[model samples]
Target: MDDDIPTRMFYAGRRWQVTDMPTRIRDSVWATEPGTGRGFYGWRFQATDETGESFVFDVYPGAEGWHVHHCYA
Candidate 1:
């Protein structure tokens, strides 16, 4: 995906084994690796700008490499 694109992204559930993340805070935005609370890990984040636009963002492990998706509302 284009890095310049501004959108909202966030973890859906308790991704990874880590319960607390410094990135997960009410501020500008953040990103993290999503996991099954044990094995494997992926990337997720929420992006927004001063405009207030938002998009649900998530990246999962793919056969070739990493697959990312952005949902807008």
Candidate 2:
């Protein structure tokens, strides 16, 4: 298993290289199941391309595959 954390990804049909630390998204300190939606949630990170265009992205895995939940310019 590759335990290494992800620092880059192909998003928006482009190379979005992570430029900042990938932060794990977590729910509040309540609830149950799925580890209380803690680290089990997903991730948010910022990335930029070769042209320096950047975006903030939120992604998570569904039954199919990793899906982009939202994005910000």
* Maximum-TM-score candidate: 2
Cα lDDT, model 2, residue 11: 72
Q: Kindly report which residue stretches of model 1 are placed more than 4 angstroms away from their true locations once superposed.
A: 1-38, 48-53, 69-72
Best by lDDT: 2
User: lDDT tens string, model 1, 1-73?
Assistant: 3353222333343232212221212212222433323433444455443455544445555577544544344
Runs with alpha carbons beyond 4 Å of true place in candidate 2 = 1-4, 28-40
The clash number for model 2 is: 0
RMSD of 1: 12.2
Collision count for each candidate, in order:
8, 0
- Ten residues in a row with the worst lDDT in model 2? 28-37
Model 1 residue 46 distance off true place after TM-score fit, in angstroms: 2.1
What TM-score quantifies how close candidate 2 is to the native fold? 0.71
Give me the displacement of residue 29 in model 1, in angstroms: 20
Q: What is the Å distance of residue 63 in model 1 from its true position?
A: 2.5
